[model samples]
Target: MKKVYTISEVASLLGKSKETLRRWDKSGKLCALREPMSNYRYYKKEQLSFFEEFNNHQIQDSIDIKPQGDYNVLELFAGAGGLAIGLEQAGLKCAALNEIDHWAAETLRFNRPHWNVLEGDIREISFSGLRGKVDVVTGGFPCQAFSYAGKKLGLQDARGTLFYEFARAVQETSPAICIGENVRGLLNHDGGKTLKGMISILDEIGYRVIDPKVLKAIYYKVPQKRERLILVGVRKDIEIDFEYPQPTKATYTLKDALKKGELFNEDVPLSPGAKYPVSKKKILELVPPGGYWRDLPLDLQKEYMQKSFFLGGGKTGIARRISWDEPSLTLTCSPAQKQTERCHPEETRPFTVREYARIQTFPDNWKFAGPVSSQYKQIGNAVPVNLAKAIGESIVKFLNEKRLIEQSEKSLIAI
Candidate 1:
């Protein structure tokens, strides 16, 4: 690769626009060089190291870290066993998983026959029996607005929402720690009141909520640039501090996800995938790898994008073709949607089921038990396996430290 890249080249590499690059240069986020003769701006290759894709390496050291003992986990809103499998890989045992979707529950049961898969509305379930037996409680609770009756938000104020059930589970199980994950938008949802309400409710339940942090999937071996906000709470009685997992310096790209390389031992297997309409396929064919609707000719752009052509934002996901060199954009439940098309790099079609699983870092052997569309939805909604495993390891470390402190205190009292 060249040591210096032009403005357009850097833009394409970063999946951003030239105008955005200019703004970054002005703001000192990513400075550019002015050529002596042509007065053209260029970026140094070393400067690109700040991005995850450029810094990716084959060695992944964190995968070797193991749990100290047989810690148990109770997962809520578990979808297709993504988080469950990851925790299992980190040496944490899954005591039970609660999910409402029938197909998702079937998928979980199909893969792990031994797991206690509870398929029903969480509001109907009682977690009191698991109290003191479970060490950790984790859930990917949907973000919903809580009715703020007053300045202070309580658990009762959140009734009827999924989060209320999650809080109730924590109160019932009285686990040492609880983790809640949601979309990155949750951090700013309802002008930030929603997240604040959630924190207050956890406090009311005797768990001290940690400052929420959004974790980037690409930084944890997932080949997609997806973000999830993580909310952690430690029981008030425990003095030990909880820590979030640190991001790995290495990253993976589309090639590593689909082709035989470091991320997988074999190439992606052929499987069923969604197809685009003939008209949509024709338009997408014009878009080169890593290009979107903006790359089309003026006449074609207007025809394909319609009113969106004159829209304010980039609308960059329209008819987009992913490149092998870069990480993929976040995957959606449906790949063929106009707003978020996930077309293949070489072929003019949407990614296959196996390809979708690979991008999420799922093992090839893990099968979905539903229709093709249902399979896509299950895979799309899952937490990336690698990202979940990283968090699981952190949970294990925290629990282990707490255990040691308890044992030492017991010995001191005996003396």
Candidate 2:
């Protein structure tokens, strides 16, 4: 069992003043236990379990997600290793990972010493060597259009586009299935013509494309209501049906994202973070919880918004302060971007570095490497690790079922 600590001890661990800790208590950011007689604040031993996802052994076991037998994977465009870690937790062993950014590649290597992280351009790598051994090929491929130069676009025409690279990998690796994730906007990009072309491209490579679906992350126990469009494909030879993971009934809130709770075992750890300039800080203090700049005084709203104040409808993200009681707004790459701001509910500033990682469901101890701004970009671009874990579990189940069918077929053939 873990040792319980006093409020001061926890505060010391978090690097905040006792007064700020009390403020967090009042705001329900951190919950405290009261001693029966003195009514003094303290935390329980059980709280630590929520701060860290895996046990003292940082290597999260696959059995927790009910992983099937050993399964291996090759991932492309793997950023910050959020999805890869999640998949690893879900029982898939990563054979190799391709990440273009140097910082992100370093971040991956820093976290998992054993991972084979390929740090360079995707176009230069040949995946043909991995053809039969890899069970899955996954990527969050950037959405780019293949010119309808011939109207009926095929593998040859998609060569220059990122999706072409992704398809090329699929063709080379010959994995049982290929998983591609993208922004929800892809559903309607170029009036849905782009998606249609993507499907046609998959068909050209001898794979059957499933109708793509946009998954709302909140449903899978993530606090934020972010969405991603998941595109799945099966080799033309297989008749297996894929199943998506079922969502948990409970909905996590922003409070859950940042502090100690089921999502994390400890109050978030202190890390280097950015601070807002005095001018921006002063303006943000006026915004209330769950409120934006428009929630401020009329004159201040116009002053803060400038000429754009008169331009359009509710740009809710403007000068927006998140509510502790509610889910956070979808996070942007820059936490304090002027147009798509995410103000700390009570404090007149942006979320700190550790706070941003919490919102993305990264484990507290999973240190990020790079400058503060670069760290923010990496976290913002990652798929919430929890969401990826859920997807991984679902894929594992499908593969297990496929494995069983193959076994049964072998038995019948022998008979």
Candidate 3:
């Protein structure tokens, strides 16, 4: 492994601009070293230890950590089994999975024949029988606005939203812990009122909601720069604490995901992928690896961008081609969409279905039971499997601690 990295290499690795690195150097935040002969700025690999995703042996060891016992999870809104599969990988057994999408439910049942999959609207399902039987209740509830009837947001305030169904499940199951995941924007949705409402609802149901956190997928061995905001609630009656999973210091890149490297044993299997129109393909051919619409020639940029060319913000996702060396940008439901084009690094085409699954850390044998577009949507919307596994391990550790504490109390009472 190389001990030193050039300015450009460091910038790419850290996902920062060269100008930002120079600013950091000036401020002594992440100072670069001067090469003795050339005086060019360079960074030592050791210096990168400050970043949570720095490549390190300790990080690799952490990734090998596993759960202490067999915990059970009841998943809601379990689209395509990304979180369910991840928890299984971390040693948790799935009690049941509920998904509204028929194709997604079929995908789950097709991949894991033994999983109890319930397909329908969440509002119609009753989890009363699962009370005290399930260890955890997990969901990726869609963010929706709650009716502000009073100063305090109550359960009824969220009645029409998907989050209401998630909260209802948690109340019905009365699990030791409940986890709800959403997009990062949820933190500030409706000016942060939506999340506050959720926290209040969980509190009313006797679960103490932890301060929500956004886990970056790249820090958890996922080969994409995706982010998911995780909300954890522990039963207030349980005298135990729940901690979010610690991020690993090692990061995987597109190469690890698509090629035979640390993340996979074999190269990505080829499958059907979305294609760009002839006119769009010609425009993307000009964009190099790591390049976007802004990299095109002046006339072509204007022609391709049209009104977007004059837009203020950097529309970086337009005509973007992923680089093999870096983690891929967060995937969208449709790879060929004009707003969120995820073009291949070497080819003018979008990533194949298998490649999409690979980026999301799905195992090679796990197949999606749906059309190509549906498969892409499922993979794109999923919480990266590696990230979910890391979280599952943390939940297991918490459950073990709770069990030990209960055992100690029981022995004292016996004495």
* Whole-model lDDT per candidate: 0.88, 0.79, 0.87
lDDT of each residue in 1-415, candidate 1, tens digit only: 4688787556545646565776798899999999899988888888898785444432245546667677999999999988998888888999899999999999999999999999999999999989988999999999999777679998888999999999999999999999999999999999999999999999999999888998888778888888899999999999988888776756678999999998899999999999999999999999998888888999999988789888788767778898887788899999897769988999999999999999999999999989999999999999999999999989999998988898899999999
TM-scores, all models, native as reference: 0.92, 0.83, 0.91
Q: Candidate 1, residue 17: CA error in Å?
A: 5.9
Backbone clashes (count) for model 3: 0
Ranking of predictions according to TM-score: 1, 3, 2
List where candidate 1 sits over 4 angstroms from the true fold.
1-19, 22-29, 34-63
Local accuracy of candidate 2 as per-residue lDDT tens digits, 1-415: 3367686445323323344556778898777878899998887766645542212212222334465577878999998987898888788989899999888999999999899998999999998988887888999999886577656778787778899988998899888888899999999998887788888889999899888988767666677767889999988888887776665645567788888898888787777767777878878888888777767899988888999899966677778788776667778888877778888777777888888888888887677888889899998998888889888887888788878888899999999
User: Which is the winner by lDDT between candidate 2 and candidate 3?
Assistant: 3
Where does model 2 exceed 4 Å of error?
A: 1-65, 149-151
How big is the positional error of residue 390 in model 2, measured in Å on the Cα after superposition?
Answer: 1.0
- The alpha-carbon lDDT assigned to residue 62 of candidate 3 equals 61
Over the stretch 256-296, how does candidate 3's per-residue lDDT look in tens digits?
A: 99999889999999899999999899999999887888789
Q: Model 3 off-target regions past 4 Å?
A: 1-4, 7-9, 16-60, 63-68
For residue 138, give model 1's deviation from the true position in Å: 0.8
lDDT for 340 (candidate 2) = 82
| Model 2 Cα shift for residue 236 (angstroms) | 1.7
